[model samples]
Target: MLEYAPAPESRSVVQIAPSYGLFIDGDFTPGKDVFKTINPASEEVLSEVALGSPEDVDRAVAAARRAFETWSARPGSERAKYLFRIARIIQERSRELAVLESLDNGKPIKESRDVDLPLVAAHFFYYAGWADKLPYAGFGPSPRPLGVAGQVIPWNFPLLMLAWKIAPALAAGNTVVLKPAETTPLSALFFADICRQAELPPGVVNIVTGAGDTGRYLVEHPDVDKVAFTGSTEVGRQIARSVAGTGKRLTLELGGKAANIVFDDAPIDQAVEGIVNGIFFNQGHVCCAGSRLLVQESIAEQLLASLKRRMSTLRVGDPLDKNTDVGAINSAAQLARITELSEIGTEEGAERWSPECSLPDRGFWFAPTIFTGVTQAHRIAREEIFGPVLSVLTFRTPDEAIEKANNTPYGLSAGIWSEKGSRILAVADKLRAGVVWANTFNKFDPTSPFGGYKESGYGREGGRHGLEAYLA
Candidate 1:
């Protein structure tokens, strides 16, 4: 077999500090304790990060509160300019940020460079334009900013998720205290420098880094007026209970087990490609990844063959390698979860398969995988694996496909692969998911709204809808 020669993005683009501190009140401050964040691709210790304590959260919220008074008092146009400046700075420093993201997050550098960085900048640019036009955003004639937003983002898409929550909240004139996921804290910390360069007001944005307890401290802090989270549904439930009557506006983008339904009439080649992109992109760490494949029985065999062939071709190696298609799993714990779930799939009588691909020995890794003969009753088909694993099930009719697709509690995102426009429209409307795509998978834009239904959580992010959550 012909092999791809190593073509790695230079690591020199990013400069990692030996130790990091919490960004509170527009400055880096010492924390009570600290932890190390490692590069998952090489298992190399990237940097030491402060483990934020409740006191740290306190300072962050207090800073946000103090800044909120003046921040909320700023003219919408002034806030827009700040957001615009931040957006421009992100573009200028994107290469550094992208390299840092790949090192810390274990995602392929190409994704961080091409998809994640561009969208991160676009989101800021999108919300910046909305800063001065909140009254016309359909929220109300004179919408108001909810003060001191507390945001918790997941490790899957660190910088992009930060942009999703912070851009809108800041644009709506609310200051923020954000806790980036413990595994991916470097990029957010680097973003603190971008804020300094933009000369944003002190306390306008604060980043506290730590594990679950620190996140709990930030979200449960009384000073927070709004709470936004993107992570597992289990934690979303806990946040809902904590904020039950706190009067804090909340939005949660949780887990998903989306179905990519490919009909018999669908183009075989395109459907195979979409299936790969849907489930394997970002190693399937996405919240709205199409983990479930619902294919018509008539074309099931053909689709499986094509999908296996394509999956075999996916390169899994060094994240910095430009030719690598898939990279390392984010962490050892996440890899264990994927491994356990995949083992259970085999024990439960589902046929498991993976392409003949060798993985790196030094760090966490998993080959692209799929489960055939899967039924909805199987746990692998029902639960969110959150890895590069796909569960394939067959259906005879469009109604059957929709039935299987909407059967789960998750309603985050789904896709259809039929060329027929009428069938696509009808099936999409009935799938009970927040976002549906036809003939494509894993596409995102700043102008479009994205969210989920049912246990996948509530409220929308992106476009005009995103501004509503931050505005009162």
Candidate 2:
């Protein structure tokens, strides 16, 4: 059993206000309905965040609409300067941002600082260069902004997701009214403060905090020219249905149950590490998490034993700790989903194993679990169990691996591990996922385009491809 130690609370490095309000027109405005954001790791009420209603959505949309006229008309170089300033400010305040994100989102402080915040800044810096180079991006005669963009981001990677939505929208000359998830709205509220610090123009970016209702209002609002959402497949489908007749541009980055395939010829140790990273990173709250494991029949038993031993040693605990590997589950609702799916795995006859780790009594937590002897038809294999759970299956040949990998409705990401160059290329070419990692998993960069296929939803989020949803 992994030893339990009470994780230390966030150090008083930066002083934050007791509550946060909606950020509109370069200022914070209080909303009518206030909601409390809890720290998922400790079940501690972090802060009260104002929830924006339909009326608030309308007000934010108006603010965005007002900003668009002048903001979009400004020279690309001027916009680039603002982006540069924001990037610098983000770097300056990265430590505070990291601590706040870990407190609010249940991800480890290391990941928030090393992975999320750095990428957030890199995204802004990368997109800033594209602001003045849109004409060269092969977008025909004159690529123009689509006016006001309504973006709804998930709680998984709160501030990073916000950056993914806002950076591209603003770079393409569109103003934004963004809605952060209710459970993790604090970092975004703090982000609005950063924008003010950067002297970003009024109304260029507005933040509205609320739950699903606010997201629905933003999407259905007639004045919203574009909609970008990162959430569940069900919600993505609903948004698609809602936006069908409106003619509004829409981009959805939804769910995934990615397949991480290991061939007989692959380097066993490296493949094992990749397997560990594929499913367990960020407690597997990632949309592109490699939840399915397809090992070649020749090495199936060996790989399973290796993976189980590795999973046994994973240090699952508080998010604030730098040494913590798997942190707390995002919420109680997510914990229920993970529990239900894990039970289903056992009911379906797959052998389940979780480390004997002691969890804090006050918070939502789940042990890193692995299910062996899983068939493709199993619920744990087909459904996206967005927690630290791995479903392992065996495949006889390359054809079988490809067949099993693409059998799901989701096509967000896939992983291929093989020593042979030809085999890696062949398998990668056949996978239907938007992002394929050959001999690696969960690799991200600001220049790489990421999205999904089929039920996983559509549109890309990074690189030049990300600009499509924001342009006419």
Candidate 3:
């Protein structure tokens, strides 16, 4: 492996102020309390952000309800123009947003720049085209926008999740009250600036920043016509219960313990790469991350050897370094959870292994690790670790692999790597996951719908199906 020189991205383009306020009614307002936002990579304080109280949530929801009457009545063509302007601004400031996202979210600059920011822009652009074409979108002659959409997004992909929630809501002519996750709220705050640049209608998009209490208040608010949430399945269930009798529309993108199966006929080299990308990308913070590896017993040894060799070369360090493959863990609490789970896996008789890599002294960090000899009953295999951890298990045949893969309650995603097309198709058909990648993993597109089945939660984001969540 070659050692690359440190190449840190300049942060000059992003001007993080000393503090930020709640974005409501087309402006920033002081909140009752405030919390600090930090860079997970360096543990550096980035900005002080407002912590929205219940009253603040009420204020944001009121703003959205007020904006909806006029915004929803606007011609779809006019709504399209605003979305186009937002998209253009995102593209123009892509570098700045990308850098800011990496700093706030602890994801590699390469992914924040190349993957996330592009998708963020594409989602808006894709939905922008749909704004004026709803009549042709198979939703009947005159589809109507839901009134006020109250959305809560996770920190894993803050800006992108914001786009997923806000774009369709706006394109469908509904106003929005979005609450970004507390740990990473800067990107969404910056997005508030973009809305201002587009001269969007006051209260058309209101961002209330805070923790669980804030999101709970928004979801339980009587005036919010629709609720969209993306986070833990536990929290998803809470949101579901909270909005049950309210008659508000709900869409949830939740947790997963996806299985990545490797057959004997798979291209071992490429399969190894896919496995690495599956579990380690974004420090394995992805909800759809492939965390379980069910390898065919016939080639299990060879695959593990190659997989470990590949893991050895992964670069883990500063998120801003272009060459860094794995970044810091998102927060201290998440790191503790990951550590506790991995320790339990070891105590339960599973074997753990990690590549020899130097970690930064500051910030929350966890080494990319894999466990062998894991069984279906093991907690590590059954639960969603949501970190850079993989559990390896062996399967005797395709039937056995399918049985183990479907055993979990999560059905978010799965991966099948095989040279035999028939076997790949046959196995994929049996997997209960919502998204199954035949040879590749972690690939996403705005035009493709993404979601999960079973306990992983319901409804879809992206593609034409995403629009249904905000429409009447």
Candidate 4:
């Protein structure tokens, strides 16, 4: 094997200001309190960001509400043009934004550049085409935009999530007040700039940076007509409770403990690749990560061997390095949670394994880890371990595999790997998850609707269904 030297992407492409203010009504406004956002890979403070106080939330919502009357009244063709302009600007600045996302969110530069940014641009492009065509979207004759939408996104896949929330809302002619997670707020601020460059209407899109309190305030704000959130199931529950009696329409893309099933007759190589991509992509920060591996008893030994061998070759280091595979954990708190859950897995009698890899001295990092001898009762198997951790369990029959896979409260996503079409169809039909992948895993498209059922939360976030979230 050849060891390649470091080829780090230049950080000079992005110009980070010393501090940032909240984006409200097409302008940057100062906030009462401010916090520093850091580079998760190096633990260096990238910039100080304003924390939106309750008053700040009120102001932003007021701005959105005021603009919604005029913005929503605009012809769908005009809305489409604005969205297309934003999409073009995103494509032009994709590299710079991808680099900024890698720095802020600790995802490998390769993924940020290849997967995240392209998807972000594609989402806007897809939704942009839908703006003028909503009448035929099967949502009734004249599907109308909901007034002001308050969207809250997580730190993982920060910019992509922002695109998911903002694009659909704007395309549907609704104005937005979005809150990016505190840990990775830079890209959203950058997105505010993109809106400016496109000359988007004032208050059509506003970004307020802050912690959970700000999100709570935005969700509770009486003026918001719709609320969209993507994060932990626990936090999703809180948001659900808060919006319970309010007439605000709600959509949540929350947590998952997805199962990746491997059958005895499956193609071993492809299945192994699918399994690795399922759990290890984005350092397993995915909400729909395939954290549980349900393999047939006959192939358990061979599959585990292949999985471990493949994991050993993964490069875990600087996020900005073009060759890096896995990168740092998004934050110290998330790293602690992953560590504690892995500890509980050991205490609960599950076997743990990781490749021998040296971690950097600074920043948050968790190696690719997998647990064997895991049972349905184990914490690691049941809980949403939103990190680079996988729990391996074996089943004897297709029925048993289905039973074990559906045993959890989560129903976000699942994967089935089998060469036999009949068995793949049968197993997929029985899985409770909203999204199922057969022979392939971790695949996403803007046209395909993505969401979950049961404790994983409700409502879809793509395709025609996504338009329903922001539409009247």
Worst 10 residues of 1 by lDDT: 1-10
TM-score of each: 0.99, 0.98, 0.99, 0.99
Q: Judge candidate 2 against the unseen true structure and give its global Cα lDDT, from 0 to 1.
A: 0.91
Per-residue CA lDDT of model 2 for 284-342, tens digit only, reads 99999999999999998888788878877878788888878888898999999999999
Give residue 283's lDDT in candidate 2 (0 to 100).
91
- Estimate the overall C-alpha local distance difference test score of candidate 1: 0.95
Candidate 3 local lDDT, residue 129? 94
Clashes per prediction? 0, 0, 0, 0
Model 3 agreement with the true structure over 312-392: per-residue lDDT tens digits: 999999999999999989999999999999999999999999999989999999999999999999999999999999999
Q: Model 1 misses residue 268 by how many Å?
A: 1.2
In model 3, the Cα lDDT at residue 163 comes to: 92
Superposed by TM-score, candidate 2 places the C-alpha of residue 303 at a distance from the truth, in angstroms, of 1.2
**Which residue runs of candidate 3 sit more than 4 Å off their true CA positions?**
none
Error of 1 at 280 (Å): 0.6
The pairs that clash in candidate 1 are: none
lDDT of each: 0.95, 0.91, 0.94, 0.94
Return the clash pairs for model 4, or none: none
Which tens-of-lDDT digit does each residue in 292-384 have in candidate 4? Answer: 999999999999999999999999999999989999999999999999999999999998999999999999999999999999999999898
Higher-TM-score candidate among 1 and 2? Answer: 1
